[model samples]
Target chain A: MSLIIKDLYARVKDGAEILKGVNLNIPKGEVHAIMGPNGSGKSTLSKVLCGHPDYEVTGGSAEMDGQDLFSLSVDERSRAGLFLAFQYPVEVPGVSNANFMRAALQARLPKEEELDAVAFYKNLRARMKQLGMDPKFTARAVNEGFSGGEKKRNDVLQMMMLDPTYAILDETDSGLDVDALRIVSEGVNAMRAPYRSFLVITHYKRLLDYIRPDVVHVLYNGRIVKTAGYDLVDYIEEHGFDFVKEEHP
Target chain B: MDTPAFNDADELSGKLRLALEQAEAEARLREAETPDRLNEDWRFGRPHIYAKALVSALESDTDNAGRITIQAPAACVEPMADDMRDGEMRLRSIGSDKILALHLKRFGKGICLCIDTVLADPIIITYETEGVFTPSTIILAAEGAAARIIERHIVRGSGLLVATRDIKAMAGADISLELEVSGESTSGSDQPRAMNITNIAAMDAQVRQLTRYSGLDWAREETVAEILHENTTIELFSANRLHGTQILDQHTRQIHSWGKSTSNLLYKNVVDGSATATFAGNIYVAPGAHETDAYQANRNMLLSEDATINSLPGLEILADKVRCSHGSASAPMDEEQLFYLLSRGIPRHDAQMLVADGFLADAVTQFRGSESDGNNTKI
Candidate 1:
């Protein structure tokens, strides 16, 4: 019924600890926003969730509906309904966006089975149109020449296409303008079904204005210090992480 | 041995004599009044490889493989010109004993075809000589008619085979030629040796030629193409994939005789399993050949650590107002690109195969052209 992260501790490299004893949980049909300032380990939490090879989990356990998550590889975790919209999505040259997404989807299909190209393209076109993306964008190389806002929108496009059970949007609004942000939020909100969950990690509350979160958590110094309702975003916007900083200090 | 003079007249004759005598090849040699290499046209950069032959015991029970198909371009005629089949031409059928010979040449305006009608599915023209062997040459001349031809060389068994072909396209006549060669397990248990020379003259005409050699054991090939005329253009592309100790050395020369003439050459080599490849290209622009443009480039990729590639691209210009450029590059696969594919759930070996296939795909793109026929590529 939920994704539970209990007593999580992670390191950037060999012994450079970044996440220390963090705990959070997001039940089905709920949207949670994690707000933290720079250098707070919010990004590390997203990367660790996706099983990035560079980040090592020393002591932690993450489960989705009672199924262990850490045991899966990065791509396996992706196929198993966990998605991470990277803060800075990678630019893969010579690989078109349509082809990359097709490969990812093909990996999830049964062995020796083929993907229906006609149906797949039709679905892709519909999703792209809903996100206000140009039809020609599917043929262009993945993020090779995309602008900052275009890259972020492309990340949202991918999340929408993958349709993961739980999506971790890592700073999805970092590079977006107001118009792009609104379009991305609309795309995300359209996919907000009762069976899906989202953990939106960002610094600003402007994104929460369009896609309201059921709960808000203040993540500071590698741990979630406080949890509140959607009004917590307003409080953070009024002041800052200083209230959480004072209590933690 | 020392390198011969750049303008040696006897080089062609000498090569013909040695090749004809060693392989006992039969072909009528038209003696050029200018002594084949008498002028500066034939020899600009001397191309020679250290010769050595490993004559293995001949196998008596080698299976007979099927025939190889050599593709030639369909005939085309200009708007107001006479058919090229009636032009002056000379045909030569050499090495009919052990080699399936077929030569088509149109220098001025005639069709000359010399075919050894007897088809040898897997032909092997071996070199039995003890010293350096000269490759036989097939001379084709077209007075003014356009011509398209194809020559396929298939080795039934392993044996050292040395051979060459010389084609001349006369003034205002276009000619396109292709050679496809491959080898198999032979009775002799030794690979073939091949030396090929092609001379093309496209005076105010356009010419395109492509050569592909692969699946040879210890095969060595040398190709030389020269373009001579005003407003004439030549598009030359060559690709070779060699395995084992196969060594391929290719040299190309483009001469700009008149103003506004253009030439381009792209040669690629892929070597694996201790194989070696060498590419040498030279572009020459003569004086008064104003507005001449030429480019020569060689790219090689080594598939294994033991494989090696040697490239030398050069340019010589005598004209003050001309554009000419040449370059040579050799490198291994990109490690970052490979890692990225492997990290995406594609197995490491499958990832490597994808990269290798992509590397060779670009070289083959030039060979394909628009076709209205329904037999276009299904892929």
Candidate 2:
């Protein structure tokens, strides 16, 4: 019924510690936002939750609906309904977007079951249209030669297609024009349901205006220092993380 | 009637017999000299061992009945001549001289196809062979004709196949050739090897050639193209996937002998599990071949840490007002690309396969689109 992380500590493999004793709880049916300063481990938390190979958890426990997250592989976490919208989507050459999406959806089926090609294309085209993407993108390589705005849109498109139970938008609003942000926000809003949860991580308050969160937490020095209503966004916008750090100290 | 009492048919037959005998003698002499690692073309492959195996197979009395099959439109199939004159001439004009000589010496009686009109269906020639098999095919496309031809070689057991293909395109003609080589082993120790030599002459025409190799223990392929007239365009592409200690060695040459002609070459290989691949491509522009444009590229994707790839791209331009470029790249699978697919619920092996497929996508696309009109390949 919730994503629970307790005393989570992680570090880059053979490198510096990134997430140190981070704890948070996101229950189903609510959207939570994490606001922090630069180098506050916002992105690392997302990657760690999705089981990126570069980071190793030294001391931590994460459970999705009472199921241990660390026990599964990276891809297993995805099929288990945990999704991360990358800040900078990687460009894959020679693999068409349609084909890539098809492979992903196909993996969810049982070994004896086969995906319906007709229904797949129909659903894909509808989703693409909803996102304002050109029909030609389906045939083009995944994110190859795509603009910044286009890449962000593609990331959202993938999130929509996968339909994970818990989705993390990791700095998804970093590089977007006003129109693109609106469209992407709309796509995220449409996917919200009572059974699903979202963790929106961002630096600016501008994104909160579109996809307002029920709770906003201030993460400073790898720990959640304050939790408040939407008013905390305005206070941080007016002031900054300095006030939060001083209070925690 | 008082002229020399010589029957033209008998005279021509006698001349052909003499020519065959001389060609066979030359081939024997060439085969006597073993190709070792010192030879530039044979350095990466075990040509010395292949040569010995070929010589022994040629000496063996293996019956080759029903080994070759051909399916073509009745009108497009031309009666093959009984003489080896045409095959000998074409073999000498292109391909490695040593390999050509061996082919002539053993299996000189080959098939000849003459295409004079546009055909809707493709002509398929298949060779199923074991032991030592040598086969040659000569294709001549008349003026304004268009055709698509597929030549396939399937090998089993400890098979050794040496193949020669010579293609000629006349003015306004369009031709596409697809050459595929595949092999399987009946026993654990069975080793399958193949050597293919292809030569093309394009005269004010468009010609496309694609060669694909897979499932072979070892293969060596050589292709040479000569642009003989202005407004001629030649495209050459190859895609090979090697795995499990497999080795593929490729050599290509694009000779722009006339002005205002264009030639392009692209070869891609995905090496996995200790496989090895080598490619050497050269673009040669003659002194008077001005306003010529030529390009060559060889790309390799190494899937495993133990996989190896060697690429050498060369350009020798002796002409003014010519544009020529060549490039070679070999690298492991992109980690970022792999993770992108993996994050979407795809397994690690499937993700790697997708990336590898994308790496060689352009070559495959270009080859598949060869017969279509107005082919504008980005590669």
Candidate 3:
């Protein structure tokens, strides 16, 4: 009952290598944090896991509940209960936020099951209010002209609506103000369940302060070079990453 | 067979006579840019269209019989004939447009609609053609009159269609003209229209023209209009969808000769299969035409890689302090937008259609706004 990855090696399609022999595991009930500096491939790991088309997995094995993850297509991976909160959510013009969400949820149902419009809207309104979002936001074209904080909140909004089994958030805290950080963190915290696990990827320690992952790992040069408890954040903040690199190298 | 049925020397007066003579002389000498002859091969995709005069129902209805007068050439006699002759001459001097010449010569009869007062109901005109056909219509909304007219053309079969529409709005008149052109070739009806439109306005008049062409095998649509007086407004919107081996070529010009007037032209095209679309729009602000506000935009979305679109957005500005914006673009659907929808589990086809719908949604929504009037018209 976990998302287990081992010997993960990936590179940009016909370009430079990004992820090099990485390994990570998050059991069903635990949350893990991966922090690294720019060019260390923290975001690349998240995209590689979600089957982004630009990345090529040279050598790796990832599985959820003993099911082969690499065998599924991008959409298939998503339908099989895998979710990634993109750092920069794409703005889809002509598709309303509400309509986009409805389509996403509708795709999860069986072919014979009809989606209930009344229940869908009723549930959507409740979830939106919980995230402190205006009901009018549902009508706005998906992500187009959205403020930075609003787009991040929208990401969490979708995350809450999707309810995937194993969710990975890449830099979900970047570009957010203090107030927006609290709202997004609260949304994630509300979704924390014993059966659902999270791999939260961020460059800063502030996001960890909100989500409070049980395990912290330092990703350097595309590898998980160090692993520790939550207190490792205080050490890295007080001392910095140069010592960790020196000690690990 | 050579003599056109509308050719009655005593009945045809003014520019109509001169134009028919010119067309006949040109025919005798050679085919001089006739309506049947296309200016150029459609660069995107070409469809073989035959032009022939067809005999079918020319459906028409008008409101308030006392306030409206519908006439054909013979029904228009001496005194009113003089007035109609003046309009004919003006239409001729406007341009050397061959479609107008075809309307002057080949089209045997046309409806002359005149509304003298604000109408309680709207006017509806429907023209459906089988085989080769030609039709002409004239609309005149007299001074201080407010009226709406809807014109539809449904063409079928292997035939060429030569058509013309002329609209005159008097001072303080508010007129709306909506034209819909569609075709069904397999059903033996072809709506391939080689059409020309002339919209003339007087002081403080407001004219709204919306043209929509769908499923046309071959179409040549051209509209020319002038903001001739102060405080007049002209709004033009056109949307077209062509599929299979279809082609539509369009040219439009909106001139603000008088100061303190506004003209907006927006056209959108959705091309799929091996279809092609060509759109050229020109907005000119003449000198002394100060405070002229003109906006023109053309956007084309090619649904298939084989589909093609060419757009030319021209602006000739000679006035100071004129607010003008002109842009033209042709692009395939955004793959990133598609993948985003696909990532959410939408099927490939529905996802593509949704994005295409969004691409034309802005123009379509604005068009609906212009058409969002009380349409009591029943046909």
TM-score of model number 2: 0.91
TM-score of chain A taken by itself, candidate 3: 0.97
* Per-residue alpha-carbon lDDT of candidate 1 for residues B251-318, written as tens digits (9 for 90 to 100): 66777777788887888877777888877677878778888889888887777999978787888898
Docking level for model 1: incorrect
Better candidate number, 1 or 3, judged by TM-score: 3
TM-scores of all predicted structures:
0.63, 0.91, 0.80
- Kindly report which residue stretches of model 3 are placed more than 4 angstroms away from their true locations once superposed: A111-113, B1-32, B35-96, B104-163, B172-180, B183-203, B240-242, B318-321, B368-379
Q: Whole-model lDDT for model 3 versus the true structure?
A: 0.73
- For residues B70-138, write the lDDT of model 2, one tens digit per residue: 899776766656464445544532224665655665654356788888776788899886867777788
Q: Per-residue CA lDDT of candidate 3, range B1-379, in tens?
A: 5855555566556557678865564453233242333434222223223222211211111110111133223322122343453354345312234444444444334456776666645566677665445556677777887767777777666444556667777787777777887775675343454344555554678788878877666776667778889888888887777788787777778888898999888898888998878887788889999999999999888888899888888899999989999998888877778776766666667677777777666665665565454232122
Instruction: Give DockQ for candidates 1 onward, in order.
Output: 0.22, 0.79, 0.48
Model 1 misses residue A44 by how many Å? 4.4
* Rank by DockQ (best first): 2, 3, 1
